[model samples]
Target: MASTSKVALITGGAAGIGYAVAAMLATKGWLVNIVDIDQEKGVVAASIGATFYKADVRDYHSLRNAFDDTMKRHSRLDFVFANAGITDPRNFYEAQTSTLPPEPSLALLDINLKGAVTCTYLAQYYFRLCKQGSQLADFDPTLVIMSSIAGLEVYSPIPLYTAAKHGLVAFARAIATPFKESDGIRVSCICPGPVFTEKRKPSDADRLDMVPMETVCNVVSELISPGGGFGRCLRVLSTGISDV
Candidate 1:
């Protein structure tokens, strides 16, 4: 008999929040497909019972190739985690005075906003194709996007990062209803506050109030359940999580 375990595709699954979510999903009997730019970390991910694909999220062709290969291997995709992103420490306001051609650093927008958009577009396409001619009326595919507390509130240290996150929040909300109506694919965003990852600075004020990585993983696990979340943004804090 052929195994029919569900498949989950996660971008930036090599480390941090993305890796935590991928590991948790794998434990729940899911076949995890991890897409990452770092080949070394990708190899590590593959060793942990995940299928690793090397790709740059900033390039749609690279991301699409990974998506196609996963579909070919698993025959179905039940979930997509568009979790690839990078932060910019520069203050855009201060950079406006610079004379360089690319002063403010567009890397944040490219990897965070554009990458997420590419993932969402591909997720919808793949999910729709997977659901073609399905008779199960209860089928619900999902696309979980990664946002941050910056998406909901103002964060001054990283202005570009904040704007990118805010864009993600808007994107998720705008497409959630349409995606649900079109293909029963629920779209949700996770807005976590101050997770203790490599991205966190040791001298930061929020260092003492960091939320555990497990909490974010738990929230993601719950979101994957049948009919659990749709068109919702869950704000996870050190204290508790709430729908925002």
Candidate 2:
């Protein structure tokens, strides 16, 4: 409703880089909506002047309902940050097999790969809708997806993570050329090496690579900031990795 400020919706905005992005956007004078499945994270995001919506990125119905409610409450949607993801460091070959040989849990693939695809599709739909919709002439929807450095250089031991991240990088790049010139919606992705989060731990072997969560925040802030993209996956290297 304010003249200069805008509205931003961040998926996975409850913690880690998501929260950091929310904080940065809020400071930049954006009305932020932090979407995540974690209720606790939602509460935290709400505490920081952001509205919270609990939705699993993999579920279309959930996301749709959340977005519907968000738009109704806010009256407009301007930007989207699809940063929710899961990380499973297990190599594809290293996964344990049962005597029955059950289907793999594939939690990493579901949350990381499929989730990003789903989010982008939905976000793109809304971006186009805003362009066409009469009530939202001000809508210039921007999308910022979160990928990783592993997306560029294949990580030997973490094959699935790399596959998912690499998929994201390609997905975003595939759209960048056409969307930037045609749609007027800017799309960019940030591929951070390793941010210090409770979910991630760099061992003796992986100890040589990583970055701080704050540094990652800075990168995410730059991605959807009305500018274009950095084509390759962003890599936060060794010195940053050493601290983690």
Question: Could you say which candidate leads in TM-score?
Answer: 1
**Candidate 2 structure quality by residue, lDDT tens digits, 3-102:** 2457888889898888887888888888898889998766787678998888998888888777777766766677888788887755567646567765
Compared with the true structure, what per-residue lDDT tens digits does model 1 show for residues 1-244? 1127888999999998989888888888898999999998977576669999999999889999999999888778888999999877665666354466564468889999999999999999999888987554545688999999999999887888999999999999999999999788999999998898766676663565688899999888888889577999999998899999
Model 2: number of backbone collisions: 1
TM-score of each: 0.91, 0.83
Backbone clash count for every predicted candidate, in the order shown: 0, 1
Score residue 160 of candidate 1 by CA lDDT. 83
lDDT of each: 0.87, 0.74
Off-target runs (Cα >4 Å) in candidate 1 are 1-3, 95-103, 135-139, 198-208
**Candidate 2 stretches greater than 4 Å from native:** 1-4, 89-91, 95-98, 133-140, 198-209, 228-233, 238-244
